[model samples]
Target: MSDTPRATRPGKTPKHGTGGRGAAPERDHLRADCANCFALCCAALPFAASADFPVTKPAGTACGNLREDFRCGIHTRLRADGWRGCTVFDCFGAGQQVSQVTFGGVDWRAAPESRQRMFDVFPVMRTLHELLWYLTEALAQPAARSVHPAVRRTLARTEELTRADAATLEAADPGALRAATGELLLQVSELVRAAQVPGRRKNHRGADLMGAKLAGTDLRGANLRGAYLIAADLQRADLRFADLIGADLRDADLRGADLTGALFLTQAQVNAAKGDKTTRIPAGLTRPAHW
Candidate 1:
């Protein structure tokens, strides 16, 4: 009924859409490729003139490592060259989603005037894509089956946010977005923990549970904003730093756990508690400053 033509003189499990077997999904059209993108992430994001790189760059300026073809010239040795940030950043299909889905593959180079629009929307698109990644991950939880409907609804909402106008997207505050994602993630956490470790009650907010055994936990800065927590055990956690705007205390257990500079956790979140002193605060927040 889809106007799809019949193949093989009958029905032998009709071929995949016009593209071929698993073509559209396999294509992952939502993913970006430098071969097609303008390297917007590199061009739109700014980095300090730190030891990570030889120079500092402003937003919209191309990194020194970027070539005319929009590929990183030092792709193979970014870490050695202090561009390690580039190596770890994943746009989560934002680049391709914006390029193909939003703009229909209209390259900035091909349409110079489109550059302004592209730059303006790049940041918002990245945020939406990042949230999309987390939402997709949240939906994968078997224990969170109880809230699958909510997850689906939120996922749809976030997806719509991605397609919003620049004004609307920009108007979306980080705090609000964090709250939305946090609500879903918290549900996911409780579901998984309840299903796996029944009768286990872990006090998260304002409680110093450092060096605690928190294996297979998912605590990506679930608020805890301004809570007191020093040296809590957090291992095998899937932390994406989405809700780390203003967490508290420090010296928490983070061995084998992936903190990776979770969002908004200040030096206070580290210095006040009991971490290895090596507890990773977000790159934007550091010790001594909070001290």
Candidate 2:
């Protein structure tokens, strides 16, 4: 029998509290449990040789660097070996959830028939987990207190869907689910951003601000949802209480920027950008090593 690879967890600690809601959500479910995973990411997904991966790979094919035990042989040296894309990918605990819970601990190698189904469920689980992350963040915002009850209800609904079987998962439409949750999150973000001092909030929601020079910009309580900020110069920018739900921060410079209270800022976005010691992120997100 082939050995299973153990998951490598991040060095950071998760945030505590009921995510600020009446019920304490399962925070552990959001973090990747690589040890229990079947290396689905390295096998099920496709990648191309670019500034990220070192080679091109087709879907359902395993990476050359994947060890026999389902571990990445170059895990610690992914960036050094021209695999930056692999380093930025965060399943948000979807890997383990699908491997262990959805598939009932049956690995693709052990049960070849389940391989295709495993690949199908992985992305769906990722989307559901992402929604959970945003919902948890919305519930924790004190300024969004008016929307907490609704957020909790949505969170429960979303969690229920994540536990579906393989066939149900394959038939699931994550786009519709994401759209529904996004509507509520937007409402919560609006309430929180509006509570800030008048005239200080900037509204660039869904704007294409790609590569704009926003260094040292005063963006307190700005609504930058879905903004394409790829490679923007944001050094020393003030982004406290900004709603960054779907902002593309790929290669953005965040050196010396203060994002202490930024909302819906995921670790994947931060990992794709540049930052330094002075780039203050939210408590849950860890600093990227490349910065």
Candidate 3:
């Protein structure tokens, strides 16, 4: 709803444990660990008064629902209370990284003077972590094995950047890093899609298909990067091996849709869409509870 790329649902503990600082970044480290975090996402990200959020909140201001222990006071009823966006946001473990490693485990409340800076650095770190998530996924694609070395090098460099101090992180350029990594991911997508869906794949990159009646469409191996598919009726669509990087899937119906092996499909995208138990999602992503 907020259009932010999420990793996992908030207020829920991830199944994996986090590694210590200075260790190599792994998939586990890319997940949100609310226990080690200071509720930064609740304080840093601004929310508009929309269907996703009932109240208007500015950046750097703590949410009214955040409790003393940095947990959501209404965690059990966020959606019922019109805080659906919070459930969809994950911060991709950026909250803990900024709270523990970047700020040396010092919370903004304990060091009030550092609050603004911490809030400023949170989004920057989130971008780096999100890129790391995509790069990690790209590295795991067997069809993209040819670019694994490049992906590894880029991932290593990105991980090193995440270890920088708060000031360095706030001043870092995630856009440039994203561009470089995006090219490699494009190559990976091409390799994977080509191998998975042989001939005459759909080319709908960046198309405006909002609310289009696309139910049961054979869109396997389609190039849908940056496409606007909001509120589209995609029930039973064959999306296997499709490139969904940066696609807006908000409210798109995915009931019974086959998304197996979909490239660059983030949990945030899936969570934002409409789905059911029959939807076949890619491995490593959980079905939205609302589904």
Q: Against the true structure, what is each candidate's TM-score? A: 0.60, 0.91, 0.91
Spell out the clash pairs found in candidate 2.
7-34, 7-35
On residues 1-291, what C-alpha lDDT tens digit does candidate 3 reach at each position? 222222322233323222354232358778777777788888888999999899999998888987777777877778888888887876788887888788877788889999999999999999998998898888778888888788878887888888888889888887887788888899999999999999999999999999999999999999999999999999999999999999999999999999999998988899889999999999978898899
Give per-residue lDDT, candidate 3, residue 175: 86
- Rank order by TM-score, top first? 2, 3, 1
Give the better candidate number (1 or 3) by lDDT. 3
User: Per-residue lDDT for 95 in model 1?
Assistant: 65
Angstrom error of the Cα, residue 189, model 1: value is 1.5
lDDT for model 3 comes to 0.84
TM-score of 3: 0.91
Residue 79 shift from truth in candidate 3, angstroms: 0.7
lDDT of 2 by residue, 47-67 (tens): 898887778999989888877
lDDT for position 171 in model 3: 86
TM-score of 1: 0.60
